[model samples]
Target: METKILPRILIGAPGSGSGKTTVVCGILQALINKGLNIVSFKCGPDYIDPMFHKEALGLESRNLDLFFNDKETINYLLAKNSKEADLAVIEGVMGYYDGLAGKSYEASSYDLARSTKTPSVLIIDCKGKSVSILAEIKGFMELESDSNIKAVILNRISPMIFEEIKKLIEETLPIEVLGFMPMIKECSLESRHLGLVTAQEVGNLETILDTLAKQVSESIDLDKLIRIAKTASKIEFIKPTIACGERVRIGVAKDKAFCFYYQDNLDLLSEFGAEICYFSPLEDKKLPENLQGLYFGGGYPELYLKELEKNDSMKQNIKDALSAGTPCMAECGGFMYLHEVVKDKLGHAYKMVGTIEGESFYADKLVRFGYIDMEAEKTNLLCEEGMHLKGHEFHYWDSTNSGDCFHAQKPLRKMNWKCVIGNENLYAGYPHVHFYSNIKSAERFVDICRKRKTKI
Candidate 1:
């Protein structure tokens, strides 16, 4: 199959808290409103911002992490998604320079930009610094000489400061000043201890997004921005390698509590003839009847512990499904939801599905973080016994006890800690695995689900 490449734009910041999220969200909404099918991508292991992007653009926003998958796969995913859209906009992680230690260049935004050959637009917070902003842009440009920095968007600036900073940046750097937006006095996105609140949690996210789009459209030079994005060099596309399979229906938990998912994962499942049905664990009375498989992605299950505890019938339903030999694959927050108990930061405990015999407690410090390379020590639905998968772990909770039913194994750590566990027909882990890293994991998972469905 021939690949199709689209005009692309990469939005990044100097570091965290530089208003990248707000700016990116606004950009996504504005472009989407222009009747362009805008496919979005988030740079690192983030679930929340992608949700907002999806909400803004009405498209499935995918993650592009160099740590989890090879460059070939990343290129394939970018090309695959680009086919369905007029343009693609990727939001970068932490600073453009921040990435894993040993694999710094691999996981950084610069890597993604280079691999995809996408032009980048730096969103610099011009709150206090005026003249120094040029130096920051120069440093970023020089840090990666091959990087195609098309433009700079000055954020959090007053009118006086915006003009001063804009003039200095254009005079000092060899890049165009795309636009600027003043720091607005509006109710911003809610955040938790980790980061911004998940899009599922925001009640009026549509209104918030509309407000954001209007703000960007009113503030930024939309025409110049589009032209800059169009100037990105187009690269040859690569089609995803889809394995042959019979059509299977999979029930995916997708609500405020369990919203972490990759667009590519879903696309892979679709490519393999699996029909995905999304159900909310928070609102759904029970799982879809006679579903072939259950996929519970990661989210802020800790925040809605009380509500989850109240849904005793739903908890029991999931426990019964697992006990009946239904294959299940769960990531960090989803893994916690299957445990016996999940305690919040306040030490209040809530009853979970009890499929996995463990109690998860919120710790003051981060337990596991960063990329991991895992070798499956035992057979499970997600991977064959000895198959290796690259993934990452980012969480604050620690499992103090795993009751007699479950066991953790094959611990791997580079910068963060990771472990896998199994109980009943379910395989759970702290490391958030993206199926793009190993398509075999998805195929194996669906195969187990098919077998379980036949038995039923």
Candidate 2:
């Protein structure tokens, strides 16, 4: 792979709830207003923040997970997506230093910053301490000497105390104080049990984004920030290894219950000429007509168990399609929906699609969490036997029984409450696999669906 140079900026924070999302949204809009073709990304396993990025820039924002996606694929995705864009902005996960099991290899913002060789701008929450802010920035910079910390943006700073903090940071840290935003109460994003409220649920989002962009542009130094981003080192680009013959049309379940899809996955599908059509499992009677494949991403299926149970016909239609050998892929929440029954945290049970002969129950403890290198033990839609794919597993649900129905590889154990399943045509697991890491998986899935169409 040859090196490909592109301007990029990473927006991260000292920790979660530090107003990083607000800062990123403002920066994205500001860049877009400058007529720069901007592409955005989220560091960890999140589907909602990217949505806001998309709305702000009017271009789809993708995700890069050190846990669920491999290094090669991450490089390829950044290279491919950044081809026509003037700049790429990535939002970090949790704290900049937080990682999985205390290891920096997976789920860490620093891991992603290093992997892409992008320069980072720390967004520090300046509430009380003024002069001591320099120490915090120095600690983060020294913690990861390899990472490029170009600038710092102080968020939630009161105008009365802003000059003191800015002067201290400028006098001490080697980096520049790019800008700061006053503590605007209305500018904060709405939140729910999982994370930020889904982008769809927020009504006045456009007005909010526009206001945020205007405010940041008026306060921040855009020219210096752009120069800092341009100074970052470049990464090599790699072409996708997997290819397909014709466009494959896939039906995806996209309701309130199943919405946890990686934007990059959908973008890659489109690149391969796959037409994605969405259907509501909560209302639709059947899958989209003439669909070549079906994908069920993760979401809060447990919360809407009663509504899904009431949609008996849709559940039966999915079960019948699976029984007829349709190529279908289901992730964690999707996996739960395919089971015979799903019991919530309240112990309320509801009937689900019985495509898999098992029952899922919400557990008091998380069943599994962290990165996994999964190798196929048998050929399926995802990959051929022995091919490995990198992904992460995080769920609070556990299965009641294994049964002798589906087959998985060594690392996946039934007793450990990692994987459970139904038929060969149907795959449901806790680990969420980003398609870019294993393009062959999507190719194989589409191939199988096309073959099934030929038989019909």
lDDT of each: 0.77, 0.77
TM-score of every prediction relative to native:
0.90, 0.89
Candidate 1: minimum summed lDDT over ten consecutive residues — where?
402-411
lDDT of 1 by residue, 219-255 (tens): 7887888787787776665565667577678888988
Candidate 2 Cα RMSD after full superposition onto the native fold (Å): 3.2
Give the local distance difference test score of model 2: 0.77
Residue 431 displacement in candidate 2 (angstroms): 1.8
Model 1 clash pairs are none
